[model samples]
Target chain A: MLASSSTRPRRVAGFLAKSAPAVISVGLLLVTWELYANHSGIKPTILPAPSRVLEQAILNRGALIDNAIPTIRATLLGFACSLSAAFVFSVLVDFFQPLRRALFPVFIVSQTLPLVAIAPLVVLWFGFGLAPKILLVALVTFFPMLVALVQGYEATEAEIGQMLRAMGAGRWRVFVLARLPSALPYFFAGLRISITYAVVGAIFAEYAGAAKGLGIYMLNAKNNFRPDLVLAAVAVSAVLTLVLFGLTVLLQRIAMPWERVGREPSGKGRRG
Target chain B: MSRLELRHVRKAFGGLDVLADISLSVGAGEFVSILGPSGAGKSTLFQLLTGAEHGAGEMFFDGAPLDDHGRHFAFMPQRDALMPWRRIIDNTTLGLEVQGVGRKAARARVAPLFAEFGLVGFERHFPAQLSGGMRQRAALLRTVVQERDMLLLDEPFGALDALTRAALQRWLEQMWRHHRWTALLITHDVREALYLSDRIYVLSARPARIVREIKVPLPRPRDPTAAAAPLASALEAEILDILLNPQPFKGHDDD
Candidate 1:
């Protein structure tokens, strides 16, 4: 009876502990900003304090909301394009070795070219609306996804593959049963990196030139010398990134509940 | 009639030969054990039989070559090899599921064996959740669930603790009698070989060939006899001889 009673509360406590890192991080940054504003004696227009920023955020919630919608839409659209493209390319690389061999070097070389250098080119080719940002996000995200998939797929044991073959399992069955299941964790790991890349990449492209998005807002605030506004836009971007990445985590939770149960014992972290 | 015949079988890895002109026959419904020391190529022979690799020479199942009528037998490895993600029942149903049985139908077939093997309440439990002995039992169930006439076990209990190993061996003896299967077991344990087999084939180290064939006539449920009396001493002595002096009967290059 005692054991059963404590379980729910323990679970709640455990959840709070897992979330501690993100909370502490955002909290410490907020505190630092408040202190810096207090000590600097800067004018509110140039660099507003956290309290002033919050008041402006509240007062301009209408404006912030109007801009946030377009930015969120672009990020999601770009992320979707990036994911679908990476998945197809990864499958292609896995299926055809010669293609992978030829393209892998090209991909490495592509990464060496700065996004700043390439974003304008992508924007010029695809135009300003949504296509260029989506294309940029896909370019940034695809490499890590492809590399991760190949590594995960390659790590499947030859012995297990042979065992499946001996069972009279077909090639597809061997892949689905052994290789696919083993690669799931690695796939999720790649997805986390891809999601962050998607948002950050989209924003970077927007900074190069976009009519809308938080990147443009940051650029406007920086030009006007409103550090608080820049910081506010940054805060919104961080939260947006967190939401996208958190959604990936939640998807993984639903997809692979067995992972959490098998991996860590209760109360193992140093959160307290 | 012989259920299996390894006819003049030869296997080589590049310059090194693993099985040299080996030949053996197993009678239908016979409980045969292949007993040999470690690195005796016993596992390699089993792998050949199971088609883990293609090799020279004919491996006939019931008069037909294995190439002609495959998928009629099941092979259980030394390790459980259960997928960590799958539940015990799911693991048990793997072979049938692989054979195109629906999940519901396959799981239904395995529902009966759970009670018999003390796995009744643990159907939903994953392989990681089960003990070593339980995992082996689960792996064995996967093989048997296929309605296979012949079962090839490769040291299925080699990883278990002594007490659990002995208990499971007795359980296996019962299971074999209750449900007759032409079984070929590979084990290095002489007592286990003597306890479980109708006949035991002792093989020489690398490029393994049969050095001795010991026939155990100790009768049904031999675990009792194996545990007590002169029977234990005799089996121990026979196994000890191979361990103490293995030079004269050495076969081919050491594995």
Candidate 2:
């Protein structure tokens, strides 16, 4: 306990040191942008100064928060639906080879169909409401998770399945015992990718049409020649994406606690 | 009556014959081994017994046709197939759980064997947290806890290094002596067979047929140091020669 406590600060310092380069680079870029916007003789409408964007963000914080609430709700709702739909579909594909062969290629083709193009149509069909935004987000996010789950299920060692079967396990038992657990890491990997897109997906759907959201706010701000507000909205959306991504990583750790335990340098160098 | 018997078991994958006219038997509580070179279809024999693969065969378990596949045997593969997600205790209880035993009951049943299997204090630890030898022991514990009629072990210790393999072999020998479970082991290691089994059936390469059956001329709970002794080394050399020299496949004989 004493040794670990002593090293705690050092470990934290190590982490900060490792991330220092990224932090420094981003800081430098922001500084350069701030200086350029102030002195480049460009109109504030085209590209507002960082200070103006921050000032607008603080001034219009109420509007930003209100608009953000709707977008956040749609993102969370859509992603939950996407996650369940992906899991159920992946299990079906894993169980039925014929279904996998028939549907997997179609799903792959569907991913390439440009969610941007489809968002307008979805909004047209469902109208300017929360439903279209949720549907659009679910559509855009479900495929990565589906592909991850399918591949993860396939990644189980054949001998493990054979061993399970020899123990009187039937098809469902084998799946529960071997395939599902093996797919967890892959599931999380797919989840991380999907989540990074969730807020962006929700925003894009709102861009096509929406009653109220960050995307709608940005659209209004852009039309009204308020680039500072537009930039503030982009910042808010980026922050939302980061929060969701972080949540996914946390969820992964909680779900698969064994992985963390495995990485702790076991004094016994044994792997079978 | 023998606990398990296979008569005229033959398997051919597509056009290639794997196990050609194989027959063997393990009497009650007897430890038997199928010794052969790699790709000698040694595993195919176990596969046949487990009904994982179908072939022309008559399998009898206790004077009856062995039709119920799951009831008769517990199988251990080359690698310790413990799910990385499950705790060591959970892994050991997996077979029992599959047999319709409740998790709580299964845990209660296997709780005592953890100490015996050298897995004490690792009940909650995952497979990855333990050493390779411990993991294999946990795998064996999983198989043994099921309390099946026999164990079909396909190169159970083949993946371990020489030192760990030797240690596990000695441990397994002691376990077998105590439990007297009927076990059929497949391996290319001559010494492993000589050390462990009451009888060893040597098989010819591919289209495998039983080339010879030798009764182990050693006593129970055999000393590992005795492996270097004249009698054991001589038998080992003889088995190695038989494995190295491929005899032509003669036509099937009706015994």
Model 1: per-residue lDDT, tens digit, B114-185? 888878788987666667777778888888878876888989899888987987898999998888789999
lDDT of 2 by residue, B144-232 (tens): 88999999899999989889899999999988999999999999898999999999999998889988888987987798887898989
C-alpha lDDT values of all predictions: 0.78, 0.90
C-alpha lDDT (0 to 100) for residue A47 of candidate 2: 92
Q: Which segments of model 2 are wrong by more than 4 Å?
A: A1-11, B251-254
Residue B76 miss distance in model 1 (angstroms) = 1.6
TM-score of each: 0.89, 0.96
Candidate 1 residue runs with Cα over 4 Å from true position:
A1-6, A17-29, A42-48, A95-98, A157-160, A263-272, B224-229, B248-255
**Tens-digit lDDT string for candidate 2 (A6-50):** 979998999899999999999999999999999989999999988
Error of 2 at B72 (Å): 1.1
Find the 10 residues in a row with the least total lDDT in model 1 chain A. Answer: A263-272
